[model samples]
Target chain A: MPMWEESSLVRVVPSARPRKLAKVPFVELADGRLQGVVSSGSDISRVYVSSVAAGDFAFACRTNNNRPCGGLRGGFCNHVTALVGEAVLQYGGARVARYLQAETAEAADAAGTAAVPTAQQLTAAMSAVRPQQSADGQAVTGQVFSRFLRHLAYLELPATTAPLPEMHWFPTAGAVA
Target chain B: MRADLLAAELPDLDEALAAVDAFDEVLAGGLLRPQPAQAAGLNALADAVAGSPIAALVAEAAEKAAAGVAGEEHLVALAAGRTALFGAVHDAVLARVDEATGRPREAAPPFEPGAPLPVNLLASARAWLCDVARAGWRGMDHELAATAAPVVSALLPSAELRRLAVLLDGFAAELAASCPGRTLEQIPLRRWADLWARGMLLTQPGAIAAAGAAAESAAGAASTALTGRLLPLGVDLHEHATGVQAQVHAVFEPADGGPARLVRASVSAPKPDTVVGAGAWQLLRPHLSLLAAAGEGRAMELTGMPVTDEGDLLWSDDRAHVGESADVFTTARVALPAVRSGATAPLDRHPTRIAEPVLVEGYTVDGSGAEVAFVIGGERLAVDTGRVPAASPLTPQAVAGSRACVGLLRWDAGRFRLQPLAVQSAAKSKAAVAQAGAWAGGTSDKNAAKAEKAATDAVTVLRERAGRLLRS
Candidate 1:
């Protein structure tokens, strides 16, 4: 399927519920990772996905069954899945692929060496990302196709709320924040 | 050769003459060189062929390289050799300890019927007095002392009596007689000495003096009951809206038989204003971790409650129960089978059982209470920082990944945690990286902000220089 054909992440989040994913403030950082924040009860969640790093993850949430009310707990959840899905819909799969590539390039540079991606490779990847053809051998598009994935990844009622820490958790070791 | 000789560079002519004399002896008669086959020296040209200024500079450079550059490498090699040596030592110690102690006990054992918990208030007080008494008491194990030193250096939990009582409840009874009023309070040590020297501490001096014969007879009959023995304590602690409560069982033998002591105690949370609070992630975080590591039932001789300045039970930063002294709570940090977050290696059953501690390096906090980053097996890994007491003085700044501490690494759920039973030493913050760098290492919030900016600036400069060098 084409990059545009990649379904939106809104459907995956269980908390995205009745109204579905709230479609405002979808942010893509300088590094190409995307995030969509949502509020379930008093618990504000950052549904984040990185093409390069650990992709499709939840930061702080009110309801991760195994862990306390914050952090990247409960590895696989609707909120994290939803963010990645939404990003796919907004930026297209091509953009995600590009982000991942760029991140890899940066990492390579940091480690003292990096290979430049060839134009032919880029074009080949771009071509392969297209949607499959219809019955008439034409690209499939402009149809009322819908996507539905049943998931109970979010809260049902009174959202899980625990106190947030005074400071945020960031990996700041050698360099300052 | 003539020009080089004329430029011979010693400030003193006497040194030059001495050099010439030595060269003449070597060339003419082999006086300096005992072997006749040695290369002949030019004695007549010795004075004229004095070494050049270049020779002096070359000699100086050679000396500098040996003392400065080569010496540094030598020191590094020495340290590496020492590290390998110590690793072997560590392995040897564990091997011996494991062989002697028949290792590998179930961490979270299956439920068994046993005795109820007792709230031994004197245990905590006397444990505190153990510190007071440690100064004079001769029974301390100095070898074992090194093991518990890492974590204790930063965070020694609790200042109030209630906290101590909750942890080591069995102490006050032993320590009470030493106090002036014979109460479980922090009293002067002088009074304890006065009472102890008279041998009035056990039972009563008056009774012993007056009824010597009767006392001896009674003591002989009651020796079995009075003899000091360690009773296995199995306690289950839970946190609820009301407060923390513990179901303690003092198990002796025979599973079906009744316990030696049965007791019930209600534990209240700490005062809200003091650091931890109810409903706060900080409070729930450590509990979740401990529960994962040891599960419910805990077996240890000592237990402590997290108490406030006023001795209120603290559940979180803002929530706690108002309680009087002698309240029971379970927040004691267990020494064995330590938990390390994000570890890949299988936990050695033998390592945790050893009472003696190995040296642990300082660590940086990952904030979520799960991840504590440190270098182990030569790689920097973030592991779970297991079960730290609320009152323990651990700080993010001090325990940063950049610094080093001494402790053991424990693993749970595939994560390694730094179980710093005792702290060894911490690095000198920015002074470690650079002395003149404009980084302010402070404990305050403002200083934290400044340090960050300085770090960024430092990185930017470094990157720019790197880019320039790379391009060149």
Candidate 2:
């Protein structure tokens, strides 16, 4: 039930399929190191992040142990936080950016010549600057949207950009830097 | 003299012949008369013989006349003739004595005791035949009367035989009435015979064999009925508790050399590894010995096997008497800490006095991912811990940890031992980590020390944490 909160952002892969996504990056904040691996898919994939509540994060971390030590104050350990960061960078954040840019480009071509860009088109145009690689050797364009920064990096975008929906961010002053 | 005498005899002879004819008719009718009549006739004939030489000839002529008569008739004729002769003599005498006699004086004969009487042996024989015939007819009548008496008495409807028939009819009527809507008349005679034989056997030693057979059949029917009733109830109760299809197997046996019976049932259902509690033996402490003894030659048999109220097995052993007093409660408690939520409140509250021997050992997964082997209750069980293949749908953690776990703390061989699943896992993990570190460092000796240190550290951490929790 706790996973329902992130339902809109995450998709559950079919249990039968193995290794649908590749290259998850794990960032260790304690040692300032980044580690990434291309994992073969499994029946259960839980990404633990320190940004989540300590109790919730510990539960995710100890999924392997099967016994969830309930109500731990600061979460299980750093092992889980690194795993979550890697999963987001590899699978979720890059995929969303490419989809937005493609949709905006298609909408622009369909309109008459010298078509003025909408707010969504402007956001998509800025997201086109970041690039990533798909598993099939295809280029994946990243999104530069203000919301993308808030979600993937847990950072607040400057208000100088076009008007965007207000969103509350978890306290992560040290995680992003 | 000649004419008068001759005429007198002639009249006697005529009278005798007529009497003979009448006696013949009575003899032919098969009747017997009294004995006096024929004796007097023989006396007259004798007197006539003495009177004249021609008297013999006259008597002969009289006999010839009576010859046509039967034996009884001849005797009658002779008797009449004797009487007539006497009368004639008296007449003759009176005529001779005319002066003395008034109104024909009668000459009286003197009585003589030794006089010979003519008996006509042939007539007597014929008379005896008629008597014999009459006696036979009388005897037949008596016999018929005797035979009729019992038969008629029986027909009168109050004899024992008749009464029994009536009672049986009444009994049959009552039986029919009791079972209304059934066709009583159609009942087979053999069935009645069988029932009668059964009833007789119960009361009489003569019927013992039949009675025994009936008893055995009845017992079989009762056992089948009991099984049918208990089976469904067991299944329903098992499903209610475990939320799975419960399979039940049962065996019922008549007690061997005992009056009591033995009924055994086993139930199996899928159980979540997380759900744990004391085993069935712990709950049913009072009857453990009996259960163990009863289950001795049977498989999947356990002493004090846990059962629901409906006789569904919650836990069972693969072999009987193997874990007769294995302390299931401690085993379940240690194996599943998730169910307990890691609370050890009960241990301090009810301290168990350890007075027996025990041994302690830890096991873990080898490099090949096969579980470490350990022994409990004299049976070896392995916990499977393996990494999930990358291609597998199951995650690495679920593969490594998903196991049917059990733990035991025992006093054996003069020592106390604790065998817990957590300890097993920790040992396996440490070994694997050491082996990996050794390979990475390219020095087995260095890695061995490192592994020992790591194990020491882990044990120290666990002890400290457990102590703190127990103190709190």
Candidate 3:
């Protein structure tokens, strides 16, 4: 996704007004996890979220504490929420729906059906289930559904988020270079 | 309006304030005989603890930490007193802010930029000399009396030449009150340097900078004298450059100090390139924290990959938005001989390499693609050791716990380009060990005697083993 759009998600999610910044280059890992480098003052930190493409959706940033967004402590913070939102924007609802489905679609998928609910299908199903339940029950259902969706929201689409095979960058010897 | 602006900066204040304990703990822990290199970071931390007041306590705390207390009770009382003093200052900052905004407190006079400035070199020098003498009189450093004597010399007074000198006899006499040697004249450079440093505490920061520049002018006198590129500092060049291998003995917690309102992320290597990052202190904090945690006191090698200075890459992004400039922190205070030669850790363990490193979480660092940290002195550290010159011996297989001098054009703890130099070889060292083993394989009378001794001691060993077995 374009970096400006991603930044706008920063404002949009716990999200505030968007500020133009250097483009945050987010690459899609082969396993469907979306990864990116966010500027950390002369330094850059690695932020990534797992694809429900396989199973559980996970979110992490090297700069973050055990709690998301540097342990603000209340809940998933603006940074994580924004990154996840950017992933959803980049990968499309359908792709995220696939990863989220991978996490909870054990029984039927194990039976060789392999069909997992797409992001749109899940969103529709989540909305569809609300009317049948009480208000509090719907709130709980919405919270759980939103939590799952948030992780998938940041997953890069398989179409654009290709990451190179495993490799790391290190310094070589000689004079400074 | 000022309070409102300061209110907007509360987060930065919070960080500097919060860092009080972490920074104070490190300083207090090493209160005894703290190295000169430890001073800068501690000063930065102290600023956050209580602004200038905590700073006033630093020299005294350093003295107390150095002077052996009679008991732990005394030490605890000394520390508690310092803590209480710091708390008072912290409270004072908040209290003043509230008071200023709430009542009719007179506004602080604004700084007049174009006013006559203190550029009277002679007056400042005399003032500094008198201060040094007074400090000696107060028993701060009696050796300073020797340094003060030369400034008062007839020839020196007539010539008005500011130069390095050695007044060896006066110092010993001043402290001992009965020494054989009288005050001597100007001697050789090295001896002059040694005695000159002995009286360094007597010299003011402005004088030190002047001396540094003067030393630069006398570069032709000494063969090993710092010149064009050999010195740690760059001449007319922007990016800082050099090769130094030293342990990161301590990483001071990020703190704000000085008139510039800049927070400094200063590191001191054995051959340290302490490029103090100032002005944007608040924005520069998180980066300092990482440098504090990851590279502090750890064997790290960095190269100043200056774009012009035969370096490979720039650690800072050329296209990145400029936040702060190196020029802002330039002052006489920055000219202190930051690291004493004695402060550096022995450097025979690490391999030499340089690069503009970022320390990404999952990139392969070593040749073996091992995710393991570089373990040394029982601390696990992650340093980028991946790519190198074909002739370089800094591969992961080669780099271990060796001390590395880091060369850099600049350092803010946020972004710095460092190259490791003077690396001690792991392969050659292991090969030497293997060679020793091979020599052991040869028949030597000492080895034979040792074997015989082992055999003779087998009975005692057996009894100990049997007893252990019985207990089990």
Per-candidate clash tally: 69, 14, 37
Ranking by TM-score: 1, 3, 2
Order candidates by DockQ, high to low.
Answer: 1, 3, 2
lDDT of 2 by residue, B1-472 (tens): 1112211222353443333333322222222332234323333454454465445543553444334322433333333333334234333332422321111212222322222212232223223322322222212222221222222222113221221212122222222222221222222221222111121111211211221222234345543222111100000011111111112222211123222111223222211111111111111212222233222211222333332212223232321232222222232233211110111111111111111111123323222434444443343433222211111112223223323222222211111222221221233443221110011111224633454344334334323322332233
Interface RMSD values, listed in order for every candidate: 27.7, 41.0, 30.4
Model 1, C-alpha of A40: deviation from truth (Å): 21
Model 3, runs deviating above 4 Å: A1-177, B1-227, B230-395, B401-424, B429-472
| Cα-based TM-score, every candidate | 0.22, 0.14, 0.19
Can you give the lDDT of residue A120 in candidate 2?
A: 43
Give the lDDT ranking, best first.
3, 1, 2
Q: Write the per-residue lDDT of candidate 2 for residues A34-135, one digit (tens) a residue.
A: 112211134223221221211111112222122231323333234333334343332332222222222346445766664434434433443344322122
lDDT tens string, model 1, B266-298? 122221111111122222233222221122223
Residue A78, candidate 1: alpha-carbon lDDT: 45
**Tens digits of per-residue lDDT for model 3 on B345-424?**
11100011111111111122232335334332333334433222222223444444333322121111111222332233
- Residue B50, model 1: Cα distance from true site in angstroms: 88
